[model samples]
Target: MIELLIEQRRRNLGGGMSVGRVLPFAKRRMVGPFIFFDHIGPLDLVAGIDRSVDVRPHPHIGLSTVTYLFSGEIMHRDSLGYAQAIRPQEVNWMTAGSGITHSERLEKARAIGDHLHGIQAWVALPTADEESAPSFTHYEGNDLPSWSDGGVHGQLIAGSAYGLTASARTHSPLFYVHLELEARATAEIPSAFSERAVYVAKGEVEIGGERLVAGQMAVLKQGASSVSATQPSTVMVLGGEPVGERFLYWNFVSSSQDRLRQASADWKAGRMKLPDADDQEFIPLPEGDPAKPS
Candidate 1:
């Protein structure tokens, strides 16, 4: 009964770009197959003085764009050309099957000075794989799979839990851990997971007993597996292996709603082909939001 999946609070959309306080899909409530979850920017770019993040090139069929940085530097270009530069904890896994186009900037050698925190996730693809074609992967930060357990400090960047396995190659059967407790900790989550959630970013967390702070987001209700952390906290645990039935519009995630209305008529008839950036800046498509399916 503890289901409140979209609190939304991060909305700055300014120049440095910010808009991820919560945009839970299809009217809210963690849409099917996991649709949309933006938490971009921890904010603050200073180093030499360029600070970048220019998002242009759009068009996605099913979905999979999970870029997770904990602090600074991001340079990812797409349309299948693939150009990379992701620092911090490192991870830039893109998989927009069927159709693609991408852009994500802020790496002019750290945009001059250096400092550009991060978080960008949008995973929704499982309708036989939603076209399945485009692909890209980059998992650095020591290749992911850190471990501590007592003083807390775990990192399994994508799929698989406890035992550890984070090379970032998930289509389903997901996990995505990244805990970091300092004083107290305890984890044992595995009830087979049909759905689960937890997204704190700094301190305090006790799931199952309740007590989650720092940006709050704790949704767990289907059988209630297991999760713990009391003091030195920093969490992010997503579930997986369920692509039951889906069809989300906006960013286009489909199991068939006519393939999200043929990808909104191929991105409004432009046909679809935008990826390629020199400076990066193209995020426009929001007017009369209704192609049918409500």
Candidate 2:
């Protein structure tokens, strides 16, 4: 059974580019350890798109950012001094333990006028690992476990499921799987974890007799079982044990509001290091009450 259905909100990230923001919903702040999720464009990158479309360097703490693409490419540069280009089916996992700064650019897509589509999610760190050292890792598609059955294709993005484990390192119990279902095909939603949800990235799917179209997510209740595609569909199945309540503001996530405050002050005062390669410019803190958890 479905506990809640999340409608994706279209948020314009400036420069005529918009993304479907699905997580951090008001009614449900966190699903498992997954705190934030954004569905990037399946958009045509027109020639002469503004440079403003590129995401500038920004800071984060108390979480790990997971970037996976279905098409096109993203150039990632982070404070850890790693500059990597991620393509479809690949993973870019970056942990901003204590704190880290990074930027995402579409230089290649913009130059060639390509189609770009992807997902980016932020996983809240365990309270104990909130202040650990920051790190980055890029995993090739072959690095993950993939399988096909009953007209469904699956790849484990992180954590463990389907008796297969992903190479991407994880701090806590969780599962993030990418699935593609053929028309009228069905797939089982792993129920071993305490929290589970299925996101329809493309096409339509039915769960417990309920239909979900593209851009919608069904947060499943306990014992919720499987999903069947009404048509050929692409889905993202994710969730895990809760990592406890986390406070988030801007790009920061932490268990302590005091920690969030200090992070804000540090970035504002230039106490945190920006990405070595993309250090010429940085995003400033938004104007607001320091006590607010946005």
Q: Which candidate number maximizes TM-score? A: 2
Count of steric clashes across candidates, in order: 13, 0
Candidate 1 lDDT over 1-294, as tens digits, reads: 346644657665545577565536444535324566676656665645443345556677788878887777777878778889888777888888888877776655343655555567777877677798989999976678788756767778887777767888777777777777764567665446677777777677776677777676666777745556667777777767667656556666766777777677777777777765544445655564434544
lDDT of each: 0.68, 0.92
Residue pairs in clash, model 2: none
Q: Highest lDDT among the candidates is held by which one?
A: 2
Poorest 10 consecutive residues by lDDT, candidate 2: 44-53
TM-score of each: 0.33, 0.98
List candidate 1 stretches off by more than 4 Å: 1-56, 61-68, 73-102, 108-110, 113-119, 123-179, 187-194, 197-225, 228-234, 239-244, 247-252, 264-294
* Superposed model 2: Cα runs more than 4 Å off: none
Residue 245 error for model 2, in Å? 0.7
Writing each residue's lDDT as its tens digit, candidate 2 over 20-83 gives: 9999999988889999999998898976677788898999999999999999988999988999
